[model samples]
Target chain A: MPDNPQVVLKITDLVKSFDSTKVLKGINLTVGHREVTVIIGPSGCGKSTLLRCLNGLEPIDSGQIELNGQLITAPGTNWSAIRQKIGMVFQNYELFPHLNVIDNILLGPVKVQGRPRQEAIIDAQSWLDRVGLKDRALSFPRQLSGGQKQRVAIVRALCMSPQIMLFDEVTASLDPEMVREVLDVMLNLAKGGLTMLIVTHEMAFARAVADRIIFMDDGHIVETAQPEAFFNNPETERARRFLNIFQFQELERRRA
Target chain B: MFMKAAWLTVSLAFWGLILSLIIGFFCALVRFWRWPVVARLAGIYIELARNTPLMIQLFFLYYGLPRVGLLLEGRTCAIVGLAFLGGGYMAEAFRGGFSAISRSQIEAGLSIGLRRFQLLRYVIFPQAVAVALPAITATAIFLIKETSVFSIVALPDLMYVAKDLLKEGHNNESNLLLVLSYLLIILPVSLFFGRLEKRVRFAGFGD
Candidate 1:
């Protein structure tokens, strides 16, 4: 890790609730400019809700989120501008089924950013080539495989040149075989030093790529540590139990 | 005389459908936005149009309103009445289309920096049109049939001509001509809409 790393996102005492049920409770964290922070938790732990709040998709009850020193959670903030800096890829790969690969990638740039369509197309083609889907430029989402669709979704976000990207279980809805292809793209982006925050259940990928792992439970951050320390020597009982489930699953796979 | 009335009916149906679609689209948007006072007003309009019979609505506009100095020609009254009725049903159809869209789709649009109107235009409307086309076509057909009811208000539509011909001792010929004229007008229009529906049907992502 580099000394004096620039912090790109800072969260302080963030709280969110839905109908008296608190989802994210007093979360505090800072993400470095090029850090890959992976959040792991059980279902309903507010991992997705936290990511959603960062993008202003979900309103917060209290606290503030600062993106690159800008108050993103402030009242009446122009979220559209903030969102252009912070891109998100959902679990379901919400590609517009009506649009082809190139069109989907060009939508944000050409339509939202007012970039020249031809220029955006050329850029989008390069991104598709990088993902090895250049030939699929004209292919609609339904025509593509799950892995292909997810790759296009990543490129769609990348085309915007966002300062940070949030991926919420992007590979969760993919088939077992398709997961590796999407993970490879994420790994490539990580190697390229793109700032990312991911919520995922893939423990091996987390261990390999995460600069830090944040373990959450019951809408609270139970522990935050480097992957090596967190995996080998969990500091709390909750962390240990959570890791055990992964370990048990791994052992069962080995036996099988 | 029969041909003249048939042309009048066709023209009335065309104008009535155009007005209905425009009114319905905006009404649907109002409800979708869910503004407090305007949404309730739109709700009341839709309810009134849907619950009351078209004849009474026509009579109120053409006859009843004259007492309040809001007089309109018979043709204008008929078109306006039919449009109001069709708009209510069309609003529901468009609302159904809007509701069928997944929230994630809108989230994706917003996440990529699309403003509300841009999101509606590029992402939401295309998909909603796909879902709503069949219903809209059906409503158009209903609206065309509804124009026949305007004859009761002496608008000189096809039915009015047929009634006059029957009273002049040409009952069999007039009834046959009436049925054929309706079939001739409706069949081609229905087919055109059917083809439009097919062309716009979305090839949705795998189930």
Candidate 2:
């Protein structure tokens, strides 16, 4: 049976290499409508590479990425169209440091989506409130804290009305106290049923929100399982070892 | 006696700064375009103008260029010298501003489907101006001081009027009046520009 047109996104055998090293060997995944899938891995495990490749930020050596039933990596693909449908939030926040928060949110819809400025601004205002930064619309990125900046980044992506959102360790740069605020925004995003693919180190967030957890290691998908089963009874040795590190840290925190 | 020369100096400095800024803007754009030959040529010209004395540069434009059939009036030569000197330094200042902007910002602009020129004008230029404003103000001050060199070209600038007043028996009083004249002109303009710079900066255009 063919997948639904609203299936959101699919990637098949995505391969990417940098110089002599292969960052993403081959990856395949599907994101369903209104589902949240979080990819978890150790550092340098190609999780971020996979997210970047899916969004066309990093060109894949070979693969088929389909968003809204449109082939994104096919020959002569309309990349602008692909990007407009798929939004990405980077770990570093990547909020245009020069633009005010409101301007940043409106930039994509007005400029790329060709919406009127007034319409875009109104939409941006609502999205800013949704992300909990309505009062910060006039502030510069440097003026905002890490959490606020991350919220603005999310709103910036959301304003594009992307059917699928990809986040590459979105809270990785936040302070311990600030991390929760940013993740709280992501939780709200999840509650809204945004189709999302997230590469994250935040295990609590993965367990709490992800419908599916994909564990990647050495440029390969080591395992894909529901968050509860994967955390409770991981099958792959790589997944076991990765979970061991986090579990040990959690145990130490509890003992303390 | 120094009042007339002070008026002349103020006018020359004001107009010379404007001319220099116009030339600087284009030179900065040419540098920003990163045309290898053109960029190198701009670099050479700036170095030549900056390393040499402003007075000598003014004299060369006023007197020496005439020998090669490129004669211009003394005042015109002064403006040319100031513009060339300003263009050279401002080009580098602009290049610095360009480098300071993050690559992601440019990519973000492109991802939004902004054409190359639109990207530069709307995104690149506005942000670069915020970064370049300080250097621009500094260059303007340098250009103002440079207008004093026009006296060597026999232009009746402030310094020229002051010298003439002293020679015509106004003595120490001319020196005091000249100093006061410079204070009136440069102080207000610099303060106004400085305030404008702060406002633009406070408006929070960054990236």
**How would the docking of model 1 be graded?**
medium
Model 2 bad stretches (over 4 Å):
A1-7, A59-64, A69-81, A97-99, A139-143, B1-8, B22-40, B104-127, B205-207
lDDT of 2 by residue, A1-256 (tens): 1223467788899888999899888898888898899999999989988877776667889978888787888877766777777788878877766678888778778766789999888888888887777788888888999989888888888888888888888888889899998888888888888888998999989999898999999899989999999999999988999899998999998999
* Candidate 1 steric clashes: 0
Clashing pairs in 2: A97-B207, A98-B206, A98-B207, B9-B158
Q: Pick by TM-score: which candidate is best?
A: 1
Q: Candidate 1 regions off by >4 Å? A: A2-4, A252-256, B202-207
Kindly report the TM-score of the first chain in candidate 1.
Answer: 0.97
TM-score to true structure, per model: 0.97, 0.85
lDDT of 1 by residue, B2-108 (tens): 88999999999998888898889889988888988999999999999899999999989988999999989988998899899999989988988888789999999
Interface RMSD of 2: 3.1
Let me know the DockQ for model 1: 0.72
